[model samples]
Target: MSFLSFSPCCVKGGILPGVPRGDYDTSTLKKVGGYHVNSSDGMIGDGKVALVIFADIFGLQVPNCQILADGFSDELKCHVFVPDYIPNPPPNSAFTQVAKTFPEEYANRPWYISLIEWIKTIFKAWKWIPTFLFQGNQIRLAQAAVDNLITEGYTTIMSIGYCRGATILEYLLSSSSNVIQCAVLCHPEPKPRLYNHINRPTIWNIPDHDTFFKSNEVDILKRIMGKKVKDQGLEFECFVHKDTVHGFANRPTLDHEATKIAFEKVNNDAIEFFKRHLLQ
Candidate 1:
């Protein structure tokens, strides 16, 4: 099986700096059309175009993901829905433990020791097993969410996915579905089987320093997508962020100014892509 199908790297990076816990305002949560969506102050726009944000392993409950959804809603002037496809969200306590201990542990121990500890933190049952078993189900749920949004008067829809969710979105885009007009995938796992099935305009946000996908692997993807786009008359674009790591879009280390800028630029670029494709 390809690393994209079921790799431990798919489950990595559940924890990041500045993710919120219990203090997140539930008032910003509500069912938009038929799916539970998080938007700025729970606001839902009346625009014909809508965005579906397929969240990372942290699911819709993560503050950063919610904030990104809200940001998309405001920036695109479109109704954005973040559905919880992962029924059992990875435990916050496990990530919290890592966040609390990583810095001090890294300072005191060998670099390999800290790396081992970080691996131990993310390689939990909730992260890996459910991802393998329910990836297809996530695709179905995302399609259903988009269908519901269409029923609610959205004439066109676009999707954005992060990490494992990006893999699911790849499936969604490849499937014979017409509800989603275009898609943006961030740090997606490489699935060669589905690449041939993508017929719509798509954008891939590739990080320069991803551990899961090495430079050669990214080059292969670029070659494949580039050839396919030309041969099939499909629109495909890739943005490789320099000085970035995996999961920087949603799970950014905000302390780094470069990471912050990368996130904003990618977010804006995605919105503009949707505006060009979905709104026009």
Candidate 2:
């Protein structure tokens, strides 16, 4: 991925710096009165909010990711940026060749590490940096994407991730210059503990799905929330959705009736939170 040069206010030395205080012009929203789409694919709403989406380990090109993006885009009057960080390998991919290099423990971990290991093994097999650099390069690519969008005048940012993508988003929120004004994380894995430190309007939905979710991660989450989180001297609004697994937002895997109810909770709560807390 190509490196980005930050503006003066958002730079310290040569590195991209933290967010600078600047009022956003939220008036120039695209009207959606006559919105039309040949298919229900990627239909964005006419709300005056910009959205940033972090796809699951597979990336945003997938059907499920596009549908979620379309829903948010239409309701938020926003543009969704889905970065293709993972390069898709050919079909009937040689898993054994890649698996030989890494231990069995790494294999059992989340998809991100598995992808990283696969790239490393692929590099060992192919002797090319492209394969090995895919993981790191994709992250930097997402960062560059944030820089580009910030300059293009996006005020509010919301990140939706599942599994390994959730953990990566936590890292991005910590280091990126575009401090998301509003954010949502669905069925996050490695349970985002440090998110309590983030003062921005944020939501964390953890589903009771994989071993990672069932493991001691719940204890970790409790500990994170146990600490005092004071923004404007008020406690943040956080909701925990029990009995739901990870990737609850994906329509294909989701229990339609339950998902509809759950999403109503998320969408209504998030929109209200952003309006009350952020737009104040």
- The candidate that achieves the highest TM-score relative to the unseen native structure: 1
Which lDDT values do the candidates have, in the order given? Answer: 0.66, 0.47
Give per-residue lDDT, candidate 2, residue 208: 44
Compute the lDDT of residue 240 as modeled in candidate 2: 57
TM-score of predicted structure 2: 0.58
Write model 1 residue lDDT over 63-155, tens digit each, in one string: 556556655666666666776666666755565434421112234667786677678876764445666456766666666666667777887
Question: Model 2: per-residue lDDT, tens digit, 156-258?
Answer: 5566655445555666765636466656666565535555555554566665444456547766655565454532542344455544444444421222344
Off by over 4 Å in 2: 1-48, 89-135, 176-178, 191-197, 230-238, 251-260, 275-280
Error of 1 at 140 (Å): 2.3
How many clashes does each candidate structure show, in the order listed? Answer: 0, 7
